[model samples]
Target: MSMINTEVSDFSVQAYVDDTFKEITKAQLLGKWNVFFFYPADFTFVCPTELEDLQDHYEQLKEIGCEIYAISCDTEYVHKAWHDHSEAIAKVTYPMIGDPTHQLARAFQVLIEADGVAERGTFIIDPDGKIVSYEVSSGSVGRNAEELLRKVEACQFVRKHGSEVCPANWKPGSKTLRPGIDLVGKL
Candidate 1:
């Protein structure tokens, strides 16, 4: 089944952020847009690059009222160690959630049970805690943060203008379609 518009389940986990360990809860995610980025593990290839890419766009995401949470099955200690050691990961100012118990990985349905790791998953959640958009990629592929920012903008735009829909490659200020019988078969 599609997870679109589905409410996110309640969860509490430890996260490493800004040289401190913090507890994050589902309740905290409410009342604000959220991006839940799930990856395989810590101190591994590809993960740091993807994380740093997201960090590069963090300011723009925050300006759009979105909070980023990068999650993995690794422990909080491991997350902290990687943050301290890796130059790429060190650039991340967002929260790095540790899903050691796999509650989050399982909830997001990105867990690889055999490997005890998460896939490359990105979920865009609305302020009401419902999932607005999501993408899951193979471990070998990396995601683009700019594309994610565009998606968030599209979601926000669609939410505000319920009658219009974003078209392919739609960027902010670009034309959006207003679906109607007159528009049918016209594209």
Candidate 2:
């Protein structure tokens, strides 16, 4: 089994922050809500559009105390080059993590062994380093940043108000179901 609920496992990786590189690990991301987005190789199709969308929403995400990290098998150098050259990448302000060792991908169960790339995987890890939400998509499908925002809101709400669970298509200020016998079979 994978370590979904465990603290950032014993893995270290480097990330490209605009023009420079920085070493990062699970420990460094602790005490914050982490959105670990795993994509395919850099300079590929579909990935840039999705990344740009996330970039556009970075400030909104930050307002909710969430940190975004885009990861791929490419090295930090490659990430920097792509960011420097691609117009779609210019908007991204978050770190582009380099998972050349595939340890992070493997831990998340998104690594494609034959192609040496990761599927589209997004994991929402809470401050405790336990994964709260996870989504994996095929290469052809992109992600929705708006939906992710809603999820973040839901997670934050649940964390603050224990014993309440968000129902389907739940939004902020929406009613949450409390677990009890009286609420059984009311759906």
Candidate 3:
């Protein structure tokens, strides 16, 4: 049970965006590339660094028609507090969702019950609300925003060129193999 390559239509969670609160769901994300980055909680170790890393690349992601969301099992008030306190988090202008009820975490299947926190789950959802990529790591580990950008590029490439597939570390203008029986084991 990992929720990979599945259509996520239930985006029934409230998100904090630019000092306001709004309900964000899959419907709002139609015809848009969505990046859902989950962390354990706010005001803790490792999470701030990762958020800052994402902050460093937020403009690039926005330019590529992708919306990035950082989520945790904390309240919007808590998110606001942390954002106000931490300089790194202060630079994060993207939507930082507060999944206190764990609805979104449950939908993504990354909720850790014992600690009431979410695992380090990253999801890349396409325009059609179908997940094209997902990565789940341990709670203590952080993620790389650079890799996420590369994956988005690959996903966008495949969407444009439906007959082609991106290979490992595939950057833009790199070689992509077309799906066919002849290509199997030929690499």
The candidate maximizing lDDT is 1
Residues 1-187 of candidate 1 have per-residue lDDT tens digits of: 8999999998889999989999999999999999999999999999999999999999999999999999999998999999889999989999999999999999989999999999999999999999999999999999999999999999999999999999999999999998895499987
Cα error of candidate 3 at position 111, Å = 0.4
Order of quality (lDDT): 1, 3, 2
How many clashes show up per model? 0, 0, 0
Query: Which scores higher on lDDT, 2 or 3?
Result: 3
- For model 1, the stretches where C-alpha displacement exceeds 4 angstroms are 181-187
Output the number of the TM-score-best candidate: 1
TM-score of each: 0.97, 0.93, 0.94
12-110, model 3: which lDDT tens digit per residue?
A: 777777878877877888899989999999999999999999989889999999999999999888999999899999999999999999988888889
Candidate 1 residue pairs in backbone clash: none
Per-residue lDDT of 1-187 in model 2, one digit per residue for the tens?
A: 5555665576789999867899888787788898999999899999999999999888989999999999999999999999999999977889999998898988888999999999999998899888888889999999999899899889888899888999999998887888894388886
| Ranked candidates, highest TM-score first | 1, 3, 2
Span of 10 residues, lowest total lDDT, candidate 3: 2-11
Error of 3 at 139 (Å): 1.2
Q: Report lDDT (Cα) of residue 133, candidate 3.
A: 91
